[model samples]
Target: MVSSLQKSMINLTQVLRLREHQKSFKELEKLGAIDVYYLEAIYQLKEPTIGTISKLLGQSTPNTNYHIKKLVNLKLIEKRIDDVDRRVTHLTVTSRYSELINSDEDFWTRTQERLESEIAATDLAIFQRVLRQTIEIISEESREDTISD
Candidate 1:
């Protein structure tokens, strides 16, 4: 049985995640529909592959590839050939876009202020720890189910 504190923490994280998603969606809408998903995917992922992105976004490889090609054409992301394997390409955010996205001082400052005001450091740390553990547990369960099937 989950404690009330744990339940509240889960709800708070869900609300925060939803709010961020809404904010990101608004920002993407300002860019363009295709650009919105591309930017959102890039922002969420560390070094996501085409297949991983396709799975996450509920898009087919062909569709994802088409958008990725357009993003490449627009110079938002750079696709580099992996040094270890010439046939393997890795997608990375371009320096130009990194500057544009990272240099949005107003957004960053406002977000920082809101977080500082709303979330305590200790609570935030606990929330992050629990979230990570929950993700690992769920993933392990999924793998077990897959093996059983």
Candidate 2:
């Protein structure tokens, strides 16, 4: 029999992945995995260069460039050369991406209300903390795996 802990972990991933696929990532379904990472990092950095984006996402220059080209072709991101530095190219997402990343557009509002109503008030904070810690642990593991490779 599967342990309750294992089932909970599976459920967590299922719910999160379902939400991402159904909403936030629907328009982005055509993008590659690395492309998604670069897009998010670029969005956060406002406008960053190829090297900066590669470093931020812990990916190689050539690999990042490949995804950048794909995103550019899709018209989801824009690339422009710096006037002062002819070799420096900076990237920024188009307006569509800006709209996609808006938190208000997410199902989180309704999900939160449903969760609060279904779950006991006393356990909410504890659940939030545990969820955050779980994410951190997974992130740390990913970093460690990347470093090892």
Candidate 3:
């Protein structure tokens, strides 16, 4: 059951990613694939340091640093000096990055509206509850994996 669910989720992700890629071709050209991936990691991690990002990405510090420098130059990401440890820096995606990435997207909102129109309200509510529960479970598992690592 879990394996089937995982496959379905993977398929859904691939479909969504394809749609996003089609929508963001210009942005993709502006930021190379690797840099965009690094930026995504930084954004999702919410202000992780170089070491933490390197570990999460399974990348060498120097290689990660190189991409990070490029992102910084592009003004897509900024480094913040850790308040307690001045030597340590945390990475955050900039407002410009968010604007560039999300400003032109309303596909999700449109999809939600379509779903509301097509699905019965009670069924949609149950689907939403299941989706929320699944997300929470995944988040908890991710946290556990991060903690163990």
For lDDT, the strongest prediction is 3
User: CA lDDT of 85 in candidate 3?
Assistant: 97
Model 1 error, position 131 (Å): 7.3
For residues 4-112, what per-residue lDDT tens digits would candidate 2 score against the true structure? 9889999987887676666755778797667777887677566788887776677788888889999999888999999899999999999887877764454677889
Name the runs in model 1 displaced over 4 angstroms.
1-31, 114-149
Stretches > 4 Å off in candidate 3: 146-149
> Clash pairs of candidate 3?
none
Mark the regions of model 2 whose C-alpha exceeds 4 Å error after superposition: 1-3, 24-26, 32-34, 37-61, 72-98, 103-106
State which candidate has the highest TM-score: 3
- Sort every candidate by lDDT, greatest first: 3, 2, 1
lDDT (Cα) of model 2: 0.80
Using TM-score, rank the candidates from best to worst: 3, 2, 1
Whole-model lDDT, candidate 3?
0.83
- Alpha-carbon deviation at 75 in model 1, angstroms: 1.3
lDDT of 3 at 38: 88
TM-score of each: 0.55, 0.59, 0.84
